[model samples]
Target chain A: MTALARALITLAVPVLLVLLAVLAVPADGPTCLGIGLRIWALFACAPATSAWLWWRQRAVPA
Target chain B: MIAAFVAVMALSLLIALWARRGAGQGPRAFFVAGGQLGAILFFFLSVGETYSIATMLGFPGGVYAGGEGFVVWFFGYILLAAPVLAVLGPWIWRAGNLYGAVTIPDFFAAHFNSRLLERVIALGAIALLVPIGTMQFAGIRLVLGALAPGLPMPLLLAGAGLVVMAYVALAGLRAAAFVAVLKDALMLGAILLVGALALLHWPIATTPVATATMAAQVPVTLPFALSTIAVQALGFAMIPQNWAFLFAARGPQAIVRAQAAAPLYMVMFPLLMAVAVFARRMGLPVDKPDFVFLAAAQHLLPGWALGVVMAAVVLAGMVILSSVCLAIAPLLTRNVLPGLDGRAQQRWAQGVTALFIALSAAGAMAQVPLLAMLNTVFYFGIVQTLPGFLAALWTGRVRAGGVLAGMAVAALAIIGVRLAGISAGGINPGLIGLILNSVVLTLVTLMFPRRDGHSVMAMLR
Candidate 1:
């Protein structure tokens, strides 16, 4: 439920932005979700690379 | 005008002296205020740390110069930083408290049991942090130059420099914490006063000049906004000094609470942007673009209020930065020096702090590109630490060999990325470095796991 809420909240901004732009770009309406997806990609991003590097350090038990 | 600044300096120094008396015991008090700071003190100091002279001065100037792109960077910070702090801060606080760690290297040494690696991390932190300190000093000179134009720049710099150095050397973080109270009070008063005056002087429309300038500069498209948020968010979590605040929190719960509360800082960004928009509309000629706060304060405020604002911005930079450098230097000296007694160790640490300050000040004078590049360059080191430090505390199985190796790879990759200059397009290389670092650590740990020190981990949990 939290994830659903988060996703909905995140999409709301881009959706509004695209909707506002749609009156001008009638043919571009289909591409709005693609735009939303990219924005969502940005939102979902974290500093995961370091977590990956840290996780690589598992010591072999003696 | 000079007399006013002199008066402020004298008062700041006296306040610093009085405050220094309360700090109990030795290095811990000097470095971390013995971890006894209250919430109000913490809130103000943390905010003062955030609202550096750069943010106070350069941020408005950035909006004046580049329109809304920088505003995106500014606002995204709260989003990026709060969560990272919430999750990581508590763990670090617990570990730091448990080990009685005074510096980042102390914690590193305790976790890895390798003094050599600890010293290396210490040196990396000092090397990166110096430029940040230098910028603060440079900012002092700029404010003084504008406020008291008749006084020589060198004399003004020297006066401000001596006050900062004395307070930091005498009272350490306790002095900084107390001084930050005055600093934040002046800062809040100045920001609000200037903001109100600018609004009155040139009342902006609902969609201000910044929006118009940015709209003219770049189309209000999805790619622009997405990329803007992406770069800012990534860079926000990777700002080395800001990220290091996690280690200083009272505990995990304190960190978590601080993170949850930090979003309040974000709400003010748009307000600051509005002030800049008003300033720009009123035809403020800002060539350097880092002089907006001082310019606005001088032009818009009464003489007494202007003096207060100038002192606040300068001291905010000087005090916080000096404490940071002072705290960082001992971490290196203690780990690197061999067979020194406690007194000798203290003397050496003080010397290192002084030297670090001198070198960084010189770099500022020289205008070295390396120092200028420091804002982003240091994030590489911090990203490397993320994996080793977090894993060691969270799960007992992470081996030193694998942790160190993963760090090495991440460091190399970040350096390579930096050399390519791809990260300089405002995207954070540290974020990419972090991802690589975590992945390597995870894979290598799973392949070759350690079971020793499992009991220590259990105790913490």
Candidate 2:
């Protein structure tokens, strides 16, 4: 994949996840599901961003 | 319990001593492990730092008090910090290597070629960092005092201070990193044990309302949480010890690789939140909200396990305390008081470390209200340097004068907004100041760009 492709996906996924989380929580206001979804979104960024980073720089020597 | 605690504590000392094998005699080896930490050691050191005493104690305490409102910002900041570090981490590593920078000020001084800028940055960092030391002690006082209620506060502080100082004296950053390998392990075990117990002993027929109430569910302040997370995540890259950690990596890839995995470490947050909620549900006798984690652990774990858990908490504070001292001391010895030979620098580093610990301990014991105020300004102050640092790396627009002026204005703006108590509609004061700082730095740089300088970006291109 191109650097631009990687960068765009890297940037978009987290933003969309966060936006979905924000809308759900405030719209629902305060539910356990809302809270869980919110936290899960934040946690999801770990793998999303990390995988992208690893893919982009996999061959770069440490 | 006391025996387990003592055993772990003693083991840490031995680990520090063991790290002294073939220790070099200079500020370089003493401060940055001679700039030779591989991905694994760097991972331990960096990941261990992100989970400081604040994370162990203050995080649960926050959840216990403010619930999801607190966790959002706290967790979000840390979660976002990984990506921030992943992107910026390699650049910082390259800068450190390119400039042979040990301290943040060392980077500025070399990049800007201005000793005065170095001193100014060092002074501001120490002001920001000293209170951080006090924060550790503040948490330490609570944890240690709870363990031995009869122990004198002064004596307790002195003993903790001595152990922290010894880490620096024994092997400097290497000792901290080496010990961090074990410290992080114990910390994870403690959290898992407490979290699992919270789940296993969880009331089987609890209602959603009760769970919500226990979690202290409130209207999440999205604006404040988002702003705070943004400034703090960006500023984490600029923090003094973080920069030191970046420099400690053997290479750019080492730093990036470790940071890419850092956010996974905070997976314990849900567990922390569970522990906090369990404390509330069980009505544990928590004298302070911050003690909720300890309270839960104490109630759930057996005596020996509790001791091991408490020992991990202590190391959490002490290792961070030692790391802060290690960061600040060199800012004084190497950057502020330059021209010291390697041996002299090492000696001065030790002395400065001791002094910072003592002064912080004293402030904590005295319970100086001013220190509390400084604590509020700590992040605000540290984040002011961000404009200067970013300018140093990617652009030639920021001259020494521009960076210096930007920081001065930003610091004043942060302090002023804070003193005036304008909530700015719940936005963090640091964010406001960072904006003004960036504006001034850019405006000034535009007014007076240097023709002779090229950024690392330009050179690479």
Top-lDDT structure, candidate number: 2
| Candidate 2 lDDT tens digits, B1-461 | 88998899999999999999967766778788888887788999987756788889988887776745567777777766776677677777787877788888888888888889999999889888888888888888888887888989999999999999888888999999988988899989989988888888986443332333344323347777777777877788888998888888888778767866776677787788788767776766776677889999888888888889888988988998988988988898888898988678778777888888998898788776644346446878888888887777678657899988888888788778878888798888889889999999999999999777778656545
- CA RMSD (A), model 1: 8.2
Model 2 chain A TM-score equals: 0.44
Misplaced by over 4 Å in model 1 are A1-62, B203-250, B369-372, B422-426, B455-457
User: Cα miss at A44, model 1 (Å)?
Assistant: 19
* lDDT for position B316 in model 1: 78
DockQ, 0 to 1 scale, candidate 1: 0.05
Worst 10 residues of 1 chain B by lDDT: B212-221
lDDT (C-alpha, whole model) for all candidates: 0.59, 0.78
Tens-digit lDDT track of model 1 for A1-62: 43224323433443333333332333222322112232222222322312321232121110
Instruction: Supply DockQ values for each candidate.
Output: 0.05, 0.39
Model 2: runs farther than 4 Å from truth? A1-16, A23-36, A59-61, B204-220, B342-344, B368-376
